[model samples]
Target: MTDTDNRRLLRQLFDAALAVAQPSQCLHHFLPPPVKGRTIVIGAGKASAAMAAALEAHWPDEDLSGLVVTRYGYAVPCKHIEIIEAAHPVPDEAGLVAAQRILSLVQGLTADDQVIMLISGGGSALLPLPADGVTLADKQAISHALLKSGATIKDINTVRRHLSAIKGGRLAAACYPAKVVNLLISDVPGDDPAAIASGPSLGDATTCKDALAIIDHFSIAVPPAAREGLASGRYESVKPDDKRLQNVTTHLVATPQRSLEAAANAARAHGVTPLILGDSIEGEAREVGKVMAGIARQVVTFQQPLPTPCVLLSGGETTVTVRGKGNGGRNVELLLAMAIDLAALPGVSALAADTDGVDGQSEIAGAIVTPDTLFRASRLGINALDYLSNNDGHGFFQALGDSVITGPTLTNVNDFRAILIR
Candidate 1:
């Protein structure tokens, strides 16, 4: 296939991955039945606003009134459910206030009512209601430290669940006997309901001890008040057996695996054999890139995995330690490292991006890599190795005019990666 053909196919695969996670596709089947008293919708995440819009669109036109907070550019208009904009991947004053209101909205609910929580990636950070002793500043500091330390999502959320006033089943606890229904869009490695957005509605199996242990493991500098809260068990999560969370029912409306399947189908449509490596692949971004490059070489040189005209698809969250000062997200970072390892291997091109359309903190989604990626970089007076060392994947791709910019897709399913060999 020509480079244009290859890039088009890669783009199709990405669009397919995104389509499966959109609210219109995956959310309709999971909408809960209407309740007697009222159907209160409260949520926080990149997709919560769109989830609300989906729910309202399919409802029976009954009493459906609530609030949901999403990333600043992710909010879509909703008729009954109010959509509020907040910061994501990091909490801000807007998110804090939105969380406070979410808590207040769920209060004084009855057993006859129902509270539906639209949870997805970034929810934990969006709903930053700090615990009794911990301030939002403390939580924000810890969040920054964990993100830069290359801590896994599980560990980051473990700490977040304990420190927050409304995470790790605390949100469900607040709506006791009100039948909390969590409609989650999974972006985590394993589609663990309790791990999605720190499982604001689902019961938690982890404890404050686990949170403290993760802090120590990551060498995170926990604020004094937050540390005190953990030590005193004041910020402990609601246990799985807790009666307050008994009435909560969680459902994964969409997941990384589903998104990967969509991409695979797209690949097959283009007469390309699709190999889904896994949906839960996780590790450091650059390391994963190198490993993926090795697999692509195996396919290109030996055809052990499959013959040519094949695409390798995988989805999961990868972390960047952020040692460099340049702008780069995990997706682009992974691609840069992979390109360096491949060293202009013929007929091997790949695209890696976050399905939510925002990789890391930047508006750029991800980037594409070709067999001549390094060659093209050199032509542009760019050194791929130095870019990788400086964590400048976005810069490198932007300079090459190969960065994939999708803006806000109004949904979240973590990262999507595809390596095409032809």
Candidate 2:
């Protein structure tokens, strides 16, 4: 296929992956029957606002009132449910206040009432109400440290769950006798419900000790109050067997594996065989990219996994250990690393993107790489290596006009990566 055709096909595959995870398409199937008394809605994540809107569209017109917090610019309109915009991947004052309101909203609920929670990726950072003794500033500092520490999403969430008031099943617990139904869109490796958005409305098997151990493993300096709370086990997350969560029900409405399958189906429609290399792969973004480059080379040189005219698809959240002063996200960093290792190999091109359409700090989802990637870079005086070293994949791709900017797809199923080999 020509370069234009390749790019179009790759984008189509990515869009197919995103389509399956959209709340409007997938949420109604899993929603519960109308409750006896009141049906309160609550949520936090990049996609929570959209999920709320979808729920409202499907639910019978009744007393459906609640709130959901989403990343800034990700909010969608909902007639009955309120949507609050907040920071993501790191909590801010808006999120803290919203979280507090949610906690208060669930109080004094009876067993007849039901709380519907639209959980998704970035929920952990979207609700940053610190535990009794911990402060929001401490949570923010620790979040910054974890983002740069290269910790897996699971580990980072383990720490956050213990330090927060609403995460790790605490939110559901707050609803006490009320039935809590959580619909989750998995964005972490393995789709472990407990780690998705720190499992705000689901039960957690992890403890304060686990959170402290993760902190020690990363050498993350915790604020004095936070440290004391962890050491004293005063901030332990609600366990799986907690009685308060007995009426809580968890559902995986969308996941990385499902999205990958959708992309694979799309590839088949394009007459390209798709080889999915597992949807739960995780590691440093750059290292994962290098490994993918080897796989693409294998497909080109030897017919091991699959033959030519095939696409290798994978989905999972990858971490970026930011050591350089450059603007880069996990998806772009992975693509840049692949570009460097592939060295503009003929008949090989690739696309990597965060399913939520925001890969890192920037709005760019990711970038597409072609056989002439390095050639074009050289012509433009763009040093790929220097940019990679500074973690500036966004800068490098923007210069090449290859950055995938799809501003807030309003849903997330982690990362979508496709390496097209002809």
Candidate 3:
């Protein structure tokens, strides 16, 4: 197959992966029965708006009224449930206000009433209600530092849950006496409910002490009030057996593994054997790229894993430690690192991208890696090593016109990667 054909196949596999995670496709089945009292819908995430729209479309007869906040440009039309656009990966005034509104909406509910929470990735940042004595600015600073520190999502959320007023089961706690059901789209490595969206509607197993240890380990600069809260253990999240979560039911509506399976099925349809590496793989992005490149080489050199015509697929989140000033995103970094390690090896091509349609601070989802990727870069006077060192994967792929732009997929199941060997 030509390079064009390989790129097209890579994109087709990615599209197949995305199809299963869409709120419209995966949410309706998890909907609960309507209660006698009012049903308040509340959520925060990149996919929450789309999830809310799906709920409204399916349950037209039910009296549904509530609010959901999604990242800007991800909102869909919904008549009853109000959709609010907010900032993501960073907390802003709009997000703070929306979170406050959501917290307020769940109040005053009785046993007959029910609260349905649509949770997914990016919700932790989109729903930023700092705990008492901790300001939003403090949370913002800590969040920025954590992103740059290359800390795992689980670690970042451990701090977020401890510092937030609404996360880590506090949202469910506020809706006491109400039957709370959470439909979560898992973007974390293990699909742990306590980690997805910081477990706003689920109980937390992590503690404030754990949050402090992570902060110290990463050497994150914490605001004074935040540091005190963490050190004093004064801002603990709701524990697993918290009484308020007794009536709450958390369901995994969509997950990275299911999406990977979808991509595997797509490969099968094309007569290419698919091997799912793992859905929970997590580590530094470039190192993961190097390791995956070795596997791809192994497939070609010995065919130990599978035959020539096979696709190695994996799903999970990867991290990047930013040491340069250039634009950096985890998916692109991984792809660039992979391309460099492969060094234009024959009969192998790959694509790495975040499923949410945003790779990092950029609008591009990710990029494609071909055998001639480095060759094309050199022809254009671009040095792959220099770009990688500068943490500018976005710029590197943008120059090649290879960055996959899928504006706001309105859903996220973490990163999707496929290495096709033929």
Off by over 4 Å in 3: 60-62
Q: Give the root-mean-square deviation of each candidate in angstroms.
A: 1.0, 1.0, 0.8
Candidate 2, residues 1-422, lDDT tens digits: the string is 69999999999999999999999999999999987889999998999999999999999776899999999999999999999999987789999999999999999999899999989999999999999877888899999899889898889999999998889888999998999898998998888988999988878898889999999999999988888898999998898999998998889999999999999999999899999999998999999999999999998999669897999999888888888998659999999999999988899989999988888888889999999998999999999999999999999999999999999899999999999999
Q: What C-alpha lDDT does candidate 1 achieve relative to the native structure?
A: 0.90
Clashes of each: 0, 0, 0
What are the per-residue Cα lDDT tens digits for candidate 3 across 207-292? 88899999999998887888898788889888889888889987999999999999999999988999999998899999999999
Q: For residues 1-422, what per-residue lDDT tens digits would candidate 1 score against the true structure?
A: 69999999999999999898999888889888887788899998898988998898898876889999998999899888888887778788889999999999989989999998899888988899999888888878888888888888999999999999899888899998898888999999989999998988877899889999999988999778888889888888888999888788878999989989999998888899999999989999999999999999999889968898899999888889888897659999999999999999999999999988988878899999999889988988999989999888999999999999999998888999999999
What overall lDDT goes with each candidate model? 0.90, 0.92, 0.92
- Among all candidates shown, the one with the greatest lDDT: 3
The 10-residue segment with the lowest total lDDT in model 2: 319-328
Prediction 3 global C-alpha lDDT: 0.92
